[model samples]
Target: MDERTVRKTISQLAYCYAVNRRVSDPVQFSIAGLTGKAEKIFNSYPSYSNWDVNVSNKNLDELWNPKQIVYLTADSNNLLETLNEDKVYIIGGLLDHNHHKVFEILVNFCQSLDWKKAFLNVIPKRKGIGEEILSEYKKGEEITTVLIMLSLSGASNQPPGTAFIWISSILAIIVDCLLIMTIGLELEKSLFSYQSLLNWPLVECIFSSLFAINFFISIWLCFNGKSFSDDRTSYSLAATFSLANFVQYTLNVIYHVRTWIAEQKSAMQVIDPRGVGVTSYGGP
Candidate 1:
């Protein structure tokens, strides 16, 4: 997470807290592990303090009982049916990336590198952003490969609407590449005057939704144009990939939508009079 993400999170938290108050739900929102950008954001924004947000420069365990705090993660096998009104739940600070065992492993390994002695023949000391290792979830490779096959097969085999398939496939590649560039890139700030108005899931939702329609249209053309019905191996292969990508895009849309909604709900639902941390992480 960068300063922008952390700032956005605090802003969203404030928004949710206000919403909760409007509904007569008393909730205490706490932010722990305040350092670097986090501390700066907290201190600079008097509104946060005014909002009655609990701020701390410590870890969750240092401030709260371990058993009372539930740290939410995607890979947790223990499914929590519902939120316990008495318990405090912690959500990771980053918006797109979920912290799990794998993330811990990578972060630990990265942190260890800075401790190695240069002439000890151990791994050389280095400092780098570990979370960047598992940045964005992507299905572009499979999708792009499928699109290529579809376009090529249609063109070589001379299927009906071959031109349409080729043009659409090319456009699809452009969209996929655009999505890829957004990962670990500052295009939002550089390209848009209002960078705060943009976020990953929203951008992803738009792309996936548009591509879902694209895939649907392509699939329809495939069936009626005999791209799928053709007896030739080329057309069948193209149709197969096209269908697969369509399903993938649809799933992408559903996944992003669910993620966005859950974020909103979780942000608004954490009600604690004493206060509890939402998450702790690096910010720029």
Candidate 2:
């Protein structure tokens, strides 16, 4: 897994720990098969080293008895309906949209190892994933800004309209951040669940338009340049960041449209590899 995926996984594990600990009976978890980027994150983050958790670089088979290992795959007919404290269970990761590759390879690998197979009753949900990280990063940014604003007394040195630009940028950032969280939360909602005040598609459309417009406005503000050197630096950075957001936001809008089309046609399609097209490509 990439670093972000690893971090997200660790976060999920931490959330599970938090939830379990709050219950009358708690469970311990051992996260095995740590390697590469995942290992680095597990080691670096104190959160991953929870009270009842173990982290190891060794593979699951090496960490536990293979005879007791019940390697859980989604395709398994058997469902693990009950929880046993002593049973050794291994859960597979996300199912690829192209189903055959993961299924076949997983069966062969499990068969070769002769490990048991069963499906877990619980599946991971994407709704709250990455939420902790987003909150943390936002907190860090706000605290840093507070410190800087407290230390620097540049109100008089700033340009005439600098406060307006700053306020606009800050407001835009807050709105966009909330939009991102809302999108993640509603990712698993039913296709036509549009009764809510703000659905995912509507929020995406608003953010996409706002991001593009914000990019142009920031550009205009920077070039018009009534600002001092410090104020101009802020304007320049705002324009740069705005343009970057607009580029990525354009991709988000493309995906939103393609998903909408797929729903209408009742045919799910894999998105084109990046650099090929904006939407799904029927051809390889």
Candidate 3:
């Protein structure tokens, strides 16, 4: 990595770190397998001195516990369904087009060890910056990939720390967080138990929100038109599919909350058979 590339990479890394902190939950950041070139760049930027950059030559297997590992690969086929607080995510360290090679090798190495492994898909299925850490930087600008892992969670429903956030997924996550918060508030004020909220149709809300955002954005673009960019086709397809899916998953999340509340009210009467007029409010 040249001096310019190192500086740009650090700036992007800093931006990613800042984004993670903005979420309700923040991800922990660290770098491993640092080359001498990268080290010199880090030394130049004293501001990032506190960053956890591990220089150990220990292979990934010896360094991290397999049970707690989640590898964020550039491959789309390995989409991750969910994220947990207990796991540590491993991302590739090259910023350019060749980044997938490292992750592929790492995956094979882990498999060779017979270690139980979990793969996650954080990046979008479409072509683009799968590891979004380098999104802000211009193409052909100085770039070096850094491996970051979120071992713990302050994140919301999904993991907070990510190298990339798909344009489509970002909308869905924001909407999901809002829905969860609203439902939580409703649950707190009433006599309902946690069990009642169990199949609350959250997945429907996620898809609905994702599609709605995409549909609207696409419609707006069609009217206003879009400036030419490298990834136009993927963006167009995302918009088209979003519009189609929007109407498909229209089950209202609020309806489920109301139904749950109504059920709780009926059950409350049975719990207070004496008719003492006792009702429950959320307590600290």
- Candidate 1 is scored at a TM of 0.32
If both were scored by lDDT, which would come out higher, candidate 1 or candidate 2? Answer: 2
**C-alpha RMSD of candidate 2:** 29.4
Query: Mind giving the per-residue lDDT tens digits that candidate 2 earns over 127-226?
Result: 4424544566456545534422322211222323446556766676777667666664564553553445555565564665466456445544444333
* CA deviation > 4 Å runs, candidate 3: 51-59, 96-284
lDDT of each: 0.52, 0.53, 0.48
TM-score of every model versus the real structure: 0.32, 0.32, 0.32
Clash pairs for candidate 2? none
Candidate 1 pairs with clashing backbones: 28-272
lDDT by residue (1-284, candidate 3, tens digit) is 66677766656566555544444534455566655776677667776766543444355667778888777864665645344567777775545443233333333334332111211233333555543434333231222111112111111122222324344456666776788667634534333344654444444555556555554444434323323343355345544555456444445545566678888777665435345554453222
Count clashing residue pairs per candidate.
Answer: 1, 0, 6
Task: Give lDDT tens digits, candidate 1, residues 134-239.
Answer: 2221233334345444532332122344455557656776776676666524444423223455555445545654554555455444444433335365456546
As for candidate 3, its clashing pairs are 5-142, 25-154, 25-155, 80-121, 93-145, 95-145
Per-residue lDDT, model 1, residue 129, is 31
